[model samples]
Target: MDETWAPEACTLPTAERPFRVAEFDDLFATHLRRSERVDPQTLDLTLNPESRATVEDLTARETECCSFFTFTLTGTTELHLRITVPPTQTAVLDGLLA
Candidate 1:
């Protein structure tokens, strides 16, 4: 993901941003089964059941530093991650899958 689109609201720190991006990269490579843009403000990631814990942990940490984002996980036998951002943060959300 290109972190260039990240806005001023991100407080993850310049040094740690790449690491965060790497974590997302790993998650997408390892467990992500499907990806969809639900709307201009939202993205949906369907991951394997095995990714529940990792997804939860990552999203939690992400929300801690980037409060502009809203991450939701829902599914019974599957892991569904819904990432949402306010309309003003659409560019940041777009960078998520880039």
Candidate 2:
């Protein structure tokens, strides 16, 4: 993915980057259950129990770089992370999701 909007140049400061990387790695490695495309530019992701805090923190920081994305988390028993992007950014998101 090109990630032109959220280029590596916009990554968090060095000290924070590692922690974010570790946090996302943990989320992907153990918390994420699955991901799906709910619409042309929307992604519906399922996460395991207890991932709310991590997902919130991650998405909060993500918007700093990629404001085009909108993250909405919902559900009680099962959590869902809804990531919505504009039509102009769908291809970039598709590459990321791929």
Candidate 3:
């Protein structure tokens, strides 16, 4: 993951709130698979109150591996995200390139 791509601030209407977006890297993948479930608490580490709420809500929807998880924040300033946990090592590498 490129450190430069790390989210620095909220781009939503709740810009006053803090938020971050990070690509799932090797370390994170190892932990995620080992756990067999994505830990919301750990994921929350990169989010603000509003963004956390949004994530909590979105994660409830059923999804499949390698599918992109998209987040759209409404209100004054809109924020978008394309999150994905690739299915295989090759897929992960491909996703990173994309």
Highest lDDT among the candidates is held by which one? 1
10 residues in a row with least lDDT, candidate 1: 1-10
The digit string of per-residue lDDT tens for model 2 on 2-83 reads 2333334344565565565566666868887898888888988889869888788889987886677788899877898888
Regions of candidate 3 where Cα sits further than 4 Å from its true position: 1-45, 62-98
For all predicted structures, in order, the TM-scores are 0.94, 0.71, 0.23
Q: Please list the residue runs of candidate 1 whose C-alpha ends up more than 4 Å from where it truly belongs after superposition.
A: none
Question: How should the candidates be ordered by TM-score, best one leading?
Answer: 1, 2, 3
TM-score head-to-head 1 vs 3, winner = 1
Residue 24 of model 2 has an lDDT of 60
Estimate, for each residue in 9-75, the C-alpha lDDT of model 3 and write its tens digit: 3132233112221323422332222221233211112222344344444443312221333323333
| Per-residue lDDT of model 1, residues 1-98, tens digit only | 36788789888898888889999999999998999998999999999998888888999999988998999899968888999999999998888888
Superior by lDDT: candidate 1 or candidate 2 = 1
